[model samples]
Target: MSDAYLVRYVGGPLDGRVDTLPGLPDEPRETVTHVHLHGGPKIVHHYDLHYALEYGCEYRLREAEERDLAQD
Candidate 1:
């Protein structure tokens, strides 16, 4: 079994909330499987944090639907 925390990577599916990430405009909806890490402390009000992993990435824009909200 993969030791990676698979559960945390799975979110925003079925509810159509996944449609909200940026750069997904007109793109067929697809699920992303990955992992991230938080450091120092956790903030409830904060969304995803930019943690540097040896082999990982972070988003440059608000996730899809969240971005849509900013458009207004």
Candidate 2:
């Protein structure tokens, strides 16, 4: 399995400007795994980038090629 990295830009919708939270700052989403910046399923931050790796999501990355195509 391998790892991946992602940079996320924070800055949710404006408050009251929409129809959700009246005059409050936009709410932050959850933080991602291994990514402490931006927002994922944990902690909190703003206008930051996050790095995430998903091995299961990329089975092709771990698959064999050419002669091993049948195994794939």
Candidate 3:
């Protein structure tokens, strides 16, 4: 099994939440999409990967104009 590392989400709705994701350290810095559901239409938050730490990775919220869906 692959090692699970902490993924810290900075800014946006999921800010300050650290999730355990399984992947290699050499993975590309891609957009991280998080779907939020709260009795309404599902909202997707896109974060841009920024830095890689010793035990985790940092992802910042993408600009509003670059997002696929807009927040209500």
The lDDT values for all models are: 0.31, 0.27, 0.81
RMSD of 3: 4.3
Q: List model 3 lDDT by residue over 1-72, tens digit each.
A: 767898888998989998886765577467778889999899878899888877888899988876745544
Per residue, candidate 1 scores C-alpha lDDT tens digits across 1-72 of 322211122123222122223231343223333333387553221134234232332322237676456447
A best-first ranking of the candidates according to their lDDT comes to 3, 1, 2
> Which residue pairs collide in model 1, if any?
20-64, 20-65, 21-63, 21-64
TM-score of each: 0.19, 0.16, 0.65
Which rank order by TM-score, best down to worst? Answer: 3, 1, 2
TM-score computed on alpha carbons, candidate 2 = 0.16
Question: What's the CA RMSD for each of the models?
Answer: 13.7, 18.7, 4.3
lDDT by residue (2-72, candidate 2, tens digit) is: 23322233243211221222232233333322224454565422222132233111111111243254335
Scored by TM-score, the top model is: 3
Measured by lDDT, the strongest candidate is: 3
Model 3 residue 6 CA deviation (Å) reads 3.1
For model 1, the local distance difference test gives: 0.31
Compute the lDDT of residue 47 as modeled in candidate 1. 30
How many clashing pairs in candidate 2?
10
